[model samples]
Target: MKILAIASAGGHWVQLLRLKPAFEGHELIFVSTKTSFKETVKGHKFYSIPDASRWNKLKLIYSLICVFKIVFRSKPNIIITTGAAPGLMGIIAGKVIGAKTIWIDSIANVENLSMSGQIATSIADKSYTQWPDLSNSKVTFNGNVLS
Candidate 1:
């Protein structure tokens, strides 16, 4: 399967990378906020889009456009992300193109799902929370990446 794995830089990106083993045997095209991350993903296809947050509407649209183009061109079978803002953009883009989407909420969100995670439950095909307590009918609690 061709998977588009996207996340923002820092913790989101690190957590996304930890899921690499699960994507073994599939083609992984990674998207992040930093060009430097291209080196970290090594042999996989990598893309760096503008980093944006909910506070910046303009940049968020620009990043979404970039991600949309990537998803449109690649036509990945699945899309996944450990998110902040950019990863949400990816899910929106994938939704437009009919690619299955998955959102794994960051391990740091203990009390509740992040704003993006909450939104993803409606957008993504599968949504996961690292904390079992957060799991409900919409989001499932699977094993975490940090463990």
Candidate 2:
């Protein structure tokens, strides 16, 4: 099975990398906002897109296009993201292309699910929260990524 794993570039990337062992047997394709991350996923495929945020409309649109194109071409069996904006785009594009999407909210958002994580609850096939309190009908209380 092909799994497309995506994240922005900081804690999101770190958390995503922690899940690498889970992807051992599968074909893994990683996407991030930094091409510099290629070295980290060295034997697998990697792609980079412009980092964008809600505060930046033009960059966000461009990023959405780039992410959608990658998702469309990869045709992955599953898409997973520890997100901000790029992962959200991947989930949306993944769904459109019939791939199962998983949203793993950043662990930093203790008070609530991050904005993108909240939206992902309705879109992704599965959504997870590190905080049990944040888990509900839409999101599951998965064990901590750091643990």
RMSD of 1: 0.7
* Residues 1-147, model 2: lDDT tens digits: 999999999999999999999999999999999999999999999999999999999999999999999998989999999998999999999999999999999999999999999898899999999999988998999789987
RMSD in Å for candidate 2, one decimal?
0.6
Candidate 2 residue pairs that clash: none
- Write down the lDDT of every candidate, Cα atoms only: 0.93, 0.96
Candidate 1 local lDDT, 1-147, one digit each (tens) = 999999998899999999899999999999999999999889999998999987889998899889999999999999999998888888999999899999999999999999999998899999999999999999999889898
**What total of clashing residue pairs does each candidate reach?**
0, 0
Best by TM-score: 2
Worst 10 residues of 2 by lDDT: 138-147
Error of 1 at 41 (Å): 1.0
